[model samples]
Target: MTNILHITASIRGDESVSTGLGTALVEKLAAQSDAQVAKRDLDAETLPFVTAERFAANSAAAADRTPEQADLAAIADTLIAELQAAETLVISTPVYNFGPPASLKAWADLVARVGTTFKYTDTGPVGLLEGKKAYITAASGGTPVGSDMDFMSSWLRFFLGFLGIADVEVIAADGIMGADGEAKIKAAHQEVAKIAA
Candidate 1:
């Protein structure tokens, strides 16, 4: 069976536009394929920021590591394994302060480890993970598409592509703070439909 990893980074729970779009996309994807979905809710009970000790532990060799270091390494290993095992990944994020949420960035730091998700090669930095498709649903209260203020989507695309996920699709729910917010939302949904189709 195809394994799908669905990650939601919105703290607004049911009121999140990104979450709603992500859910709809997953539902559509499920109906189109025999996929099993696993969810990680970063906003709800988010993982702690990686500590200095944790970082030190993660870089240590297994056979030369202390118990604390070993435990932290194990957590990192599990997260990498989850990402590797998934055939597809869906990330729902709301732009915060002109960027991705802190929790999501933390999650990225934990999983994008060298020798696991990516590696440095003679050519350049190469992503170890391959054959996986990714969908990014980004919601923003400012900085509509085609505007100078837009930053989140391009940054996310670069990050994901840097990790070797070339087949990345994005749905931007922009202009969400003004009086035409409802119309913008409808347009976003229409964009999602186009992508889904």
Candidate 2:
């Protein structure tokens, strides 16, 4: 069966627009593809921020790892396994000060282990996780997605691409703190419906 991984960063819980959009898309996609959905709420279950020791532990071979290293590497192991098992990924996030939240950043740091997620080549570093499709459901209060001020979407897209998830689609509700906020959100939901269709 196909697996769809939905990762949400917004702390807004029931009130998050990005999460709402992602939920709609995931429901539709799951029904259409008969896929099993795996939800990861970063806000509720925060990942560990990568430190030098944690990074070393993650890079070490499983067989060679000490008990302490094993404890440190466990989260990365689970996160990487989630990525490896999924055929589709959905990241729903709101712009926090023109960027992604600390929780999401921490998840990224943990999952991006060398020789696990990506590797170096004679040419350059190449992503190991291949042939996966990803979607971003982004909601920004004022920062416009795809604009210079919108570091969240661009950085997320680049980061995902670095993991060989190059096929990405962005669904955004930007400038939602503006006068046309409701209209923009409604429009984004409509877009989600059509995408699912």
Candidate 3:
């Protein structure tokens, strides 16, 4: 069976435009292909930031990890496994202070383990999670998408590409605090409908 991973980082919950867009896309995908969705709610689930001890535990050889290290690395193990298992990923993020939320960053810090998600080659680092399709449902109140001031989508797109997920699509409801905020959100949803088949 096909698996779709839905990752949400909006603290606004149901009021979040990004999360709404992602949910609509996921529902359409699940209906079209009978896919099962696995969700990681970053807002509700607080992920720990990477620490020196946690990084050591995560990078250690699985067999060599002590019991204490094992406990520390468990969340990362699960996060990586989720990324590995999903063929499609829908990430919902509302721009926070010009970038992704802290929860999302924490999640990224955990999942991006060397020799697990990606590995270093002689030339450069290579991503392992290639050939997967990803969508970024980004919502910003004032920042314009893809502009110089908008680091949210830019950073996310680059990071996903670094993980070998180059085939990505971005749906944006940017500058939603502007006069045409509702119209922009509606247009973004319409865009989702067009591509969700």
Candidate 4:
């Protein structure tokens, strides 16, 4: 069975346009592919921010880690395990201050561990998590999807690519506060249906 991981950063819950559309896409994929779904809601269950101690703990050898370090490493292990197990990933987030949410950033920091998700080589840093596909839902009130003012979508693509997830599709629900909001959402759903099929 295929495993799919859905990560959400919007705190608006049911009211979030990004997450709502992402859910529709995931449901469609599950229905068509018989995929098992795993959800990680950053709003409902916040991940701990990476600290100096946690960073050191992740880099140290398993046998040499202290109790506190072990505990810290365990948290990262759980997150990484989820990512590694999934063949596909769905990330939904609303643009906040021209960037991603803090919770998403924190999760990224934890998952980008050296010698774990990535490794340093003479050729440069190489990502370890290969053969994964990602779908990103980016919602904004006014910022256009590929406009110069929008940085979230580009950054997400680059970040996920760095971790070896290069096959990414971005669904943008932009100008959500404008008069044509409904049409925009409908168009996004149409795009989702096309991709999910």
Q: Number of the top candidate by lDDT?
A: 3
Question: Where is model 1 more than 4 Å wrong at Cα?
Answer: 61-64, 145-147
Look at candidate 3 and give me any clashing residue pairs. Answer: none
What TM-score goes with each of the models?
0.91, 0.98, 0.98, 0.96
TM-score of 3: 0.98
lDDT for model 4? 0.90
Candidate 1 global lDDT = 0.82
Per-residue lDDT tens digits of candidate 1, residues 1-197? 78888889999999999998898888878767878988889888567678898888777767888987888878677777878889999999888877778988888878877776788999999987778899988788886643556666677677778788888988878778988888887877887777667
lDDT of 2 by residue, 48-80 (tens): 888889989999999999999999999899989
**What CA root-mean-square deviation does each model show from the true structure?**
1.8, 0.8, 0.7, 1.0
**Candidate 4 residue lDDT tens string, 41-64:** 988878898889999998887799
User: 52, model 4: CA deviation in Å?
Assistant: 0.7
lDDT of each: 0.82, 0.93, 0.94, 0.90
- Scored against the true structure, residue 190 in model 2 reaches a CA lDDT of 97
Model 2 lowest lDDT segment of ten? 108-117
Q: Kindly give the stretch of ten consecutive residues in candidate 3 with the minimal lDDT sum.
A: 143-152
